[model samples]
Target: MQLPIAPEGKVRFVPSIPLALQHAFAMFGSTVLVPLLLGLDPRVALMMGGIGTLIYLISTKFKVPSYLGSSFAFIAPILALKSSLGLGAALAGAVGSGIVYVILALIIQRTGSDWIHKIIPPSFVGAVIVVIGLTLAPSAISLASGGTHFSYNAFWTAMVTLGVAVVVMVWAKGRLGMVPVLVGMIGGYAFAALRGQVNWSIVAKSPWFGLPHFVHPVWNWQAMAILAPVAFVTVAEHLGHLFVAGSITERDFFKDPGLGRSLMGDGIPTILAGLVGAAPTTTYGENLGVLALTRVYSTQVIAEAAVFAILMSFIGKLGGLLQAMPSPVIGGISILLFGVIAASGFRTLVDAKVDFADRRNLVLSSVVLAVGVGNLALPIGRFPVSSLAMATGMGLILNGAFLVYDKIKPEAKDAVEAPQEAAL
Candidate 1:
């Protein structure tokens, strides 16, 4: 039997529940993958994700539809910070980023979004986006390689998974197209199971219901210094997401909920997630894809999905099942997922009509990509600025400098031209 399709607006409770479940499944793979990669408790991350969505709904007054999930931008920083200062320190840094969001929200409230554009132009953002994916390439490749030498079965399984995902995403019609990630995950899992790669013991051992392991944040100034700077990338990410959501729904969320409220919504939840030992949450593009495919923009449906996620968090067996997935499978998905992210960055540049021929743009973009991908670190007192933060800071400074130069050069040219006009 075919399920009744829910339209854009509110629908009956029974119809909305299935749509909500679909949204949850759409984001489940990526959401679970982050916690596993970071070695954090998958259950805690899932729980926080649902709770974060609720908080975001409240912060935005339920006017905007969004789902908060594990953010990819923080993966590199968190992994680095964790190796040095411990997971508590990493959580602290993630919390610090949340504070940065609130501060940006205040600034946006006082001054409109124009200042944001001045600080970080499309070229700069695009560069950062590109850097993000490119920097993670080594990690992705290592996982896919699987052990000291390449495993032939693992390689083919990954390829099959990626191939299935591409076909589903590019050619599938209606709601089916929206779930490419889930479909690909299932395909990968089935192939791995056939090859005896999946370990079923972990699933059998896990309990049906239990409280997720939760850890408290610890303060570390150095960690904060290293991680806080990432807020720049995340904020830019949020803005781009807002723009996409707005375009799809034909509702100007930036103007309606206003940028301030939206940032606060995302920021507060991030802080909460960090406090509870979960990776920071951000707006998920997968959910937006689902919305676009289903043409259902109802906040209530998203809310219901959040409730479902919270419920799943208590299901220990489910968490174990997610963790039991083979590394090669996850790596295969990351290959496409990260590439899509880089492509999205290019799309941002194109959509904004960023002029690459402009020297200022070229210089600013070059600096960000070079510093970011090259992993250049600059010492700042006790902390060294590197990774995404260093790239973001450099981009902003260069872009702002260019803006100032542009502002002054025209007037200086006019001053010289004024004499010629007088002579005429």
Candidate 2:
């Protein structure tokens, strides 16, 4: 079957512009939302996301078609650190997280990534993904309800936004189908505007052109201790995305660009994000969605999207407009997006054919869900480990324990009988 556009396919400038814009629009809402949630500059997030994608392309030798955006995984830890120690310290934690990725990449380069699979396994990784999504559920609810106290206006607006998005996702055709998130945001924003929820003065007062406000990181050991561990979870998520993309494009991204290079591509941009006071970046599922929807795997189009994002960041008014988006619209969109994220985890398990009948798999998933959803944290000295990190650690430990047990335990009688019966 002919792909709509092959990974290396060349296209003339005019048509590629819209194709690239579609990719950018697909990623825009989620990319900016992360920084907004963490009280960082959305412009910086946009800029970093663009720069990160470019860096990722270079690091992968342009063999992989992917875009990096602000990661949702680091949100809880970063927010916790920001509240306790300040933004600089939180950003320092981001730096530490990036370092973790780099270290993992280096290890994978030498020994390969088979160890990663053995340690985490598909079941454990799927559980962690579900945990990451569910852990953030309350935040979405809080945003939808208009913060600490519930408001009728906020709830209705959120519902309208979500309703529009759902409709678009299920029924929209062609290119429109690829950008449900962006479409949903616009729908929500429009509803909020009609209700006078938007504050237009922020946009009016902002300049047309300017650079994003860049903050410098302040090194903090405690902050680092809190945020760095989450990289393990993101790495697993990254691996899953690469596998999905490879399947869609009918290419072995892991073998071609290689997993080590892919991880480094993701890591370096995250390091840059930490230094420049933006959220840590990850390979975006939104980009993958566009690729699947359009069947276009063109690297040039992805690169064009990256450039478009970079250009958008410089429009000071655009940042102001994004900032002026009301809580209800954000809440409405988050409701859908976060739920989808959680559902995707279940999909992952199904795709992996994770056997829940197996005692070990059952225990691994059960414990992960309990720890992560229950928000169980373990404090070490001054630093408190997050539920997501703790859950991931526990899952790994349990899987490792199960592996050891399997090696030492006697084989099932049915297994031995089956071989003898077959011979008879």
Number of clashes recorded per candidate: 0, 0
User: How do the residues 1-424 of candidate 1 rate in per-residue lDDT, one tens digit apiece?
Assistant: 2322232357679987898999898878778878877888888888999999989888888878889999988888888778767889899999999999999999898888778866777888889998888777667666776857888877877877777788998999877788787788789888989999999998998898999889888998778768887888888889888988887778888887799999999999899989998888899999988888777788889999999999999998987888788888877877888788778888888988876655566777889988988998676664555577788877877777766766878665344334433745
Give the lDDT of residue 230 in candidate 2: 87
> Candidate 1 local accuracy as lDDT?
0.83
Q: Count backbone overlaps in model 1.
A: 0
CA deviation > 4 Å runs, candidate 1: 1-9, 378-385, 404-424
In lDDT terms, how accurate is model 2?
Answer: 0.87
Q: Tell me the TM-score of each prediction against the true structure.
A: 0.91, 0.93
Query: Least lDDT summed over 10 consecutive residues: which range in candidate 1?
Result: 1-10
Q: Give the Cα lDDT of each candidate.
A: 0.83, 0.87
Best by TM-score: 2
lDDT of 2 by residue, 330-352 (tens): 87888888888888889889999
